[model samples]
Target: MTISGEFLAFISLALVAVIGGVLLLNLTKVVHMVVGLVFTFIAIAGIYILLSAEFLAVVQILIYSGAITIIMLFGIMLTRHNDEESDSKGGGWKKVLLFLGVLAFGAAFYIGIYNLDFGTEPAALHEKNTEQLGVALYSDFVIPFELMSVLLLVALVGAIVLSRNDGEKEGDKE
Candidate 1:
């Protein structure tokens, strides 16, 4: 039997998620880990699109993949004294536990999916969804959005404060 459009989209999203998760697990280097995270974010955006939340998908790509990942890479570069020495070692029972954890998670996830009763009717697409989302954000969700902005500002200020060389008085160092 031929798969429906929705089923194909779901399968594609699942494949992306699996690939991203595997990349995240196998990569030892910081940069590679970040790249895996980007893949994961992209996969999540794809899932959001499958759910018909296009605005959320775009925001997920923009914020998590674009902004946060760049910020993380910058932080890593700024903080590391020796890039070559910073790479973490790979070995031991940790890998075994990680594998087991992933196995258990997959089992549980499959069981949950098997049990859930999704409504038979599919949702109708709203032509003005973007506009409705904007209205909702500015009117109903304004306070939470403002709070998140303040939180981000605080985090940026904290990062700056932490990275500053406060003890490096120029005359004293010489």
Candidate 2:
């Protein structure tokens, strides 16, 4: 088939996202993983822009790439882990089993998706994407949104408590 600019852009963004995810999972260093995750998030934001959802693109950049990355970096700085240590304690059979399990799950998911048919009359696409999103967030999805806020608040408190414990331990040593 013929490749258009939009198709090329989409393929490039998808490759970047996939590569970034692989890097994030395989990276040993905390900072490197964060960088990989940032790459993935930025690619997702690009995809959102390509879809003509400018508001979603901005939100993805601001929330995922900006705020979430900063928060993770801060959390990394606050916590202590051995830089030179590696976690490779396992058996070969475990890896084999895990790989097989993943393959099984993928097969199941593929079969499930392949069998589905959403009847062929295409629904009208939403116009004014930002307005629709805002209305949905406030009206239908408000409870879930508020719950997410509460979860974030709890995570912040947990981080503080962890840092404080480390400080107290250091003080005892001194």
Candidate 3:
């Protein structure tokens, strides 16, 4: 029996997601982890496209892969002073726990996949593009959206406050 196009696409996407996740976890350096995160986001976008959510796929790539990842990279670069020695102490029981957690997650996912009977009927697609998303954001989800904006603003202010070198400069003035 031949696999359907949709099934093949889903399998490929799943493989990519798993591999990216593994790479992200195994990497010791912050930059490599960030690159793996980008790959994971791309794989998730591919999955979204396979599910016919084109707008969501585009938003995933634009917001998560582009904006969020860049912000994280900048944050890491600003915060880390000695990047070479930062990851040298990563070893011991943490690795064992991580391996166990991954094994458990894989077993659970396999069991769920084998047991579940996904209906073959196709879902009716919607045409809610960017304009519709904006309308919904300002209408139904207005409060939550505004709250998120406030949260991000607060985080930015906090980062600036924490990274200020006022005390360090005062010590040098003596």
State which candidate has the highest lDDT.
2
How many residue pairs in model 1 have overlapping backbones?
0
| lDDT by residue for model 2 (1-174), tens | 899999999999998998899789767899999999999999999999898899999999999999999999998998798778555767577778867997899799889999799889975455888888899899999999999999999998996777575547655786
lDDT of 1 by residue, 1-174 (tens): 888998988888878888887888777687887898899899999999887789989999999999999998997776654435444467557788888998999999999898798789975565667888898899999999999999999998997877668676455575
Give the winner by TM-score: 1 or 3. Answer: 1
Give the TM-score of each candidate: 0.74, 0.72, 0.73
After best superposition, candidate 3 residue 46: deviation in angstroms?
0.8
List the pairs of residues colliding in candidate 3: none
Measured with C-alpha atoms, the lDDT of residue 163 in candidate 1 is 67
Global lDDT of model 3: 0.85
Clashing pairs in 1: none
What shift in Å separates residue 165 of candidate 1 from its native position after superposition? 1.1
Q: Please list the residue runs of candidate 2 whose C-alpha ends up more than 4 Å from where it truly belongs after superposition.
A: 85-116, 161-174
CA displacement after TM-score superposition, residue 116 of candidate 2 (Å): 4.5
lDDT of 1 at 125: 67
| lDDT per residue (tens digit) for residues 90-133 in model 3 | 56778888889989998998998987887798954566556777
